[model samples]
Target chain A: MSQMEIKNITKKFADVTALDNVTLKLEENKIYGLLGRNGAGKTTLLNLITNRIFPTDGEILVDGESVIENDSALSKLYFMTENNYYPEHMTVKKAFTWTKGFYTDFDIEYASELCEKFSLKLSQKIKTLSTGYTSIFKMILALSCNVPFVLLDEPVLGLDANHRDLFYKELLKNYSEKPKTIIISTHLIEEAAEIIEDVIIIKSGKLILKESVESVLSQGYAITGSISAVDSFTAGKNVLGADTIGGLKSAYILGHLDKSGIPEGLEVTKPDLQKLFIHMTNR
Target chain B: MSQMEIKNITKKFADVTALDNVTLKLEENKIYGLLGRNGAGKTTLLNLITNRIFPTDGEILVDGESVIENDSALSKLYFMTENNYYPEHMTVKKAFTWTKGFYTDFDIEYASELCEKFSLKLSQKIKTLSTGYTSIFKMILALSCNVPFVLLDEPVLGLDANHRDLFYKELLKNYSEKPKTIIISTHLIEEAAEIIEDVIIIKSGKLILKESVESVLSQGYAITGSISAVDSFTAGKNVLGADTIGGLKSAYILGHLDKSGIPEGLEVTKPDLQKLFIHMTNR
Candidate 1:
């Protein structure tokens, strides 16, 4: 069964149409990447799914049941946003205690272990932690909740490389031990590309692509060669992006090419996630 | 002449040794990635060079002359930090007008162009701008400053993918047209790898590696093959990171490997900058 499904979701904020007829089906036990430019409705869609805000028109289902204000359905999901809205006076320990009441699967021991990994002070008030520490705290809570579905929106905003790596490792380890449906909404596409099983691209409140990682990556190729040769090679092909230096030119084409006919000294390589993202959104 | 130099730099915050006798030289007309773990003194070092804070024991020279409170030396550099502290009532245009007097090379036209590209309103008060817009305002000003050395600390923090791509393209275009030294401190290593000429890796408030980008990437290789063959091949190698799925295993090894005796189903590849960073810093 699908973990979560959004049918023809639409949301409007005054004059802005934040989401327009967006439909998505999130499967079970998979890591999905919800990628889009800022203000592209990724956050709005997430909010709608988590029921932080009601959709203007359409239905959101968690395990085939409407999730809006449904305690049982909401309890099965955990959403960690970019910013924290915890009470200012709540300490880390107190926050966990509160979360334990809401989430039956909350693991105190795991939360403490995560706190140690993040170097968080349990005695310190939630408002007192640094931005990075706050993020780590939220992440720990999200992971320890053990919900069937978890939604993380730009969770690594303030984290450095070491912390990000640790988070990814911990996430994978947790997923392996207890598989769950996870959706990560982020602009850092390349960083999360390897970890995500599926990619969902949103542009101006519309879905662009939703497919497996391998299939998405296989759709484009980067080729470099002499200006004339490169131009000729890309002449009839769908060129996504192009860069030139002196007499050399490189173009990222949106389809495969016959590698054997490439000119000498030219190189053809697979396009990275970042290149593909730029190619798709920059237009 | 070196663009910037630090000799025996030391800084302390109470009992914490933020920087320990660090020394380095930055050449002109190159982009250097100043990367390190959080609180590893990357910001402290940038502060010392820009004269924002005095090092407890150190000497920072710009063109062979001490830059401590020297207007002539300070005028040659510009630092765009993660946060801006503008007056609540200050509009984008007002801030630019005030900044123009401080730098002789400030270009008003270019700044306006950048503001337009970023969709920023010059008449909007600073406090009214979104986090991303505020960053764009500061970045535009920094680029317009036309200093011999420009330092950016997480300049693209809240920016989307499209804006980031635009920023990179504009930065490279500006550099190619005017050739200046640029230092960027960011956690997005792979995204900036292509644009950066040199890299400086710091760990625990100490320099780990300061080398050209080519030299750094050349030191590692990623090998993928059958689980058994990959395991055997990487048995004695310094593995930075490893991942296994089904019968396939990919290992990020620290050094070049002899490919002649490789297994039948194995594939060798170059290590990406992010993987290299995680491997180096996680250790």
Candidate 2:
């Protein structure tokens, strides 16, 4: 098991501030959903943790050891970036051999099995692969890397519906056999909501929320009723947002709902993760 | 309004066949979901319809006229391809102008409005934009083209949850106002299910199913109960798939599910679009 800590981390690029004094601790063997709007600094934080880039301020540590210039500490982590960095001429088979050299603990046999499972040809050149195959190749490497901490950035970029389902199921199966701290930075929040145990949200380079998925979700409730009645009931309440269609209205509230005080003809249900994320992240 | 007819289209690349003997009619003023697995020839079909590539056999027509070298027929259609074909140094403003030349009906004001809504700067160069911004730029063009037939491929590739929500809502708003024939070829089936009136599924270069989304979902159901009861009840039914956790079991069944005939402990519910697509496309 491994834990990662970010202490008051801030990253600056030229004149822009990418991440601002963000501090969070990742528990051991937990799946985390790193979510934010575009350019909200999710990638910047992940890059800092992997030592690909340095923070303008603050410290990042894995197991109390700084990852900066620390080969041993970095070796225990695998960061599957959005961009492919393998040699263009390298075949999948050769790439596996080459990655095993750096990741030492990488299971070559398991990688071959995954390649077959995804129907990827080992002899196919990296540059010849389609966008979907390119993502699959990188995912296969991350899964077989045998690292204590793995970071996946938009893991299912071009995958089809069936392939995405297979990837999620395989991810769960692998996590069950060998627990690891996995952080997935993706825009597909609903697809990852159930699989991820914890959620970390950032906005405009600031950490807004960090909590278990269930606890964060428990704070949101949706009430549906006539527009006038909903407006009357939700006046001055912590209403996140609302949608109205003709005479009907659905208001999303961000606090506990008293069941006894509820108006008749009103319906209350749990808002979905994606809807909650949108309401929280919308400008 | 415009209609597209794909008559016995087949495409071949070298020794491999991409699309084989596919025939389907895209009705006027309806949103259709073009769904398939990766390498299932969804893109090939779209490319053929747009005259980007020629079909090896049969023909494609837009408004009852052949699209091959037919400028008037092609002018009514807009295909938002997966790749960005604009010049590397072209600004978003310039790209909008260039597109307007070919697509004379392009609405420059609406394009600028969409750019503002998405926070995309007109001065930013196309090659300098991020993945999310790139997708947003293309989507803005597709929505503001003012064409009678619009085809979008993976329109929300890297959009965040908030942006995707905005896009879907905008798409529906635009469709309601313009009432054009639109075909969305995307991997996010569940997100597109409600907006898409009909679904056209293909498997291994062959047309598999074409029906209304409601009709397809109505034909499938999910049953949940104890393992023994689920297995016994599904023994003679056409079971698509099942999942078991400890003593609990959930089985997916096809065909009509008689409400009163269901076992007492079992629960029946409609299957989601993603689940149904996965079952249909999985090997």
TM-score of chain B taken alone, candidate 1: 0.90
Candidate 1 regions exceeding 4 Å error are A222-268, B221-269
Clashing pairs in 1: none
lDDT of 1 by residue, B114-209 (tens): 988888888999898877887788889889998899999988888888788889889998999988999999988877897999999877778878
| Worst lDDT 10-window in candidate 2 chain A | A273-282
**Candidate topping lDDT:** 2
Per-model TM against the reference: 0.89, 0.93
Winning model by TM-score: 2
Q: How far out, in Å, is residue A133 in model 2?
A: 1.5
**Clash number for each model:** 0, 0
Task: Give lDDT tens digits, candidate 1, residues A1-283.
Answer: 5488889998989988888888888889999999998888998988888889998899999998998999888888999987677898999999998999889789999999988887888898999887788888998999999999999998888898778888988999889998999999887888789799999988888888788888878887888989888887778888888878788888887766777877777799887887787777664
